[model samples]
Target: MEINHKIKDQITGFIAANSLVLIVMAITKYFLPPFGGGNVIIFSEFVILPFLMGIVSAWCWRKINISTRKQSAWTIYNTVIAIVLSFLVLKEGMICLVIVSPLLFAFILLGTYAGKAMFKRNNQTLNASVFVMLFGIFIADSLSVHRYENKVADTITVNAPPTEVWKYVVAYKRIEKKSDFWLFRMGMPSPVQSTAEGYYLGAKRKCIFSNGYVFDEKIVTYDENKDLTFDITNQPRDPEIMGHIDILRGQFLLKDNGNGTTRLTGNSWYRLYVFPVWYYDIWAESVTRNVHLRVMEHIKELAEAK
Candidate 1:
């Protein structure tokens, strides 16, 4: 009977702790005015919140005087549960979940141990200092109001000549090469077809994606088979979730390899209006690289087909 009661208490406590985390996340993500809107992947959401979560969980465990092994188990369990809940209930996109969850978990775990140690030492001065640090980060992020344009380029050598590759780059007709990559499979959206009105400098190019997202580009530079640059006039947003990224400009450059092949380089520049430009740039770079690679590879396949 005593063992049964202990088991019941453990299950109840775990559920209660996880529920608290869920409520906090939901409040931060949904209820808060500015925190959860538009750019939800800011420093407060990713870094500070996870650290707070870790501290709370660790403090609870320490208070109860649980074994070290059990504390570790609880930390891992809470992090997993929070991520799963975010996906299932909060309806967060897979890109954010996969890319940012690891960092979140790491911060949470680190905070947990740090909190435990601080509590054990009863270090009120250190606790006050940590709170001040977090507040300072918030203030700095809020005050630094500047946008940055980040660029990412991917180059690949195609088997076909420059002329042939240029044709495909301008307006690709239905990429049958489906991306089975995990990102696309998880609904990141793959390119479908691209069509253009004219081949001149002022022409407009429209590229469609699987998820109904379309990018409308106006030709800025058209250097025959050498270079094609366009500035994005408009882009579609996901109907379900608000995307924090905006593509500003894109370019496709071609160089004639001495042989029968051509070197194709795809470049994109995007503006980051989100906070903490430095940290967000890392994720932005990664996402843009993936986007460039997928399109570049598809173009390579089509150019070589002939």
Candidate 2:
């Protein structure tokens, strides 16, 4: 009977900790508006909230004499549960969750250890102070504007000259080949085709993705056989994946190699509303590079075939 009672207490503690974490997360999301109309803030979602969850979990389970390994395991388990619940409640895509899991786990573990150390002393003042500091930081981060514009570029050598490459750069046929990029395979959209209505500045262009979503673009800079730049007038708001990111503009630059070859460069400018710019930017740059490669490679093939 004692053993069963202990097990029941442990289960209850675990449930209570996770419930508190989820409640805090939902409340934070409600109070803090996302930078650009999205519902995710990197600091709160990935760092602060997870850290607080860890501390709270440790406090809830403080009476249980568990090994460090077990505590770590429980923390990880809590993270996984939170992620699953986020997916179900927030309707976030699998790819987003996959990308966010590592950061969430890391911070949660840190919090768990910190919490254990603090609670081991049973010092109420320290705990309260820490909680207040974290809340202050969260409020400061929320109030500060986090609009960041970043640019990513990829270059490829094409066998065709600038003129030939220019034809495809302006517009290309459907890409029938499948993208080998792992992310795209996992439901992140890949570019499929591009169509242009006119051949000069102010012309309308549409870049279509495999998901049947189209990016409405307008030609802002058009230099025949040299530069083709377009502003993204409108893009999809799927909310599950890339909706939080705003793709501002894109450009294709062609340079004559003078030996029947051309140097083709693709550039993309975007603003991501997510926080912790260092981490998310890596994924953003990689995704942008791959997208550029897919389109540029298609252009290369078509230009060379002509």
Model 2 TM-score is 0.92
Q: For residues 97-146, what per-residue lDDT tens digits would candidate 1 score against the true structure?
A: 77656776777777777878888888889988886897687555534444
Q: In candidate 2, residue 92 scores what lDDT?
A: 74
TM-score of each: 0.81, 0.92
Extract clashing residue pairs from model 1.
none
lDDT tens readout by residue for model 2, 218-278: 9999999999999999998765545557899999999999999999999999988787888
lDDT for 85 in candidate 1 is: 81
Overall local distance difference test of candidate 1: 0.75
Query: lDDT of each structure?
Result: 0.75, 0.84
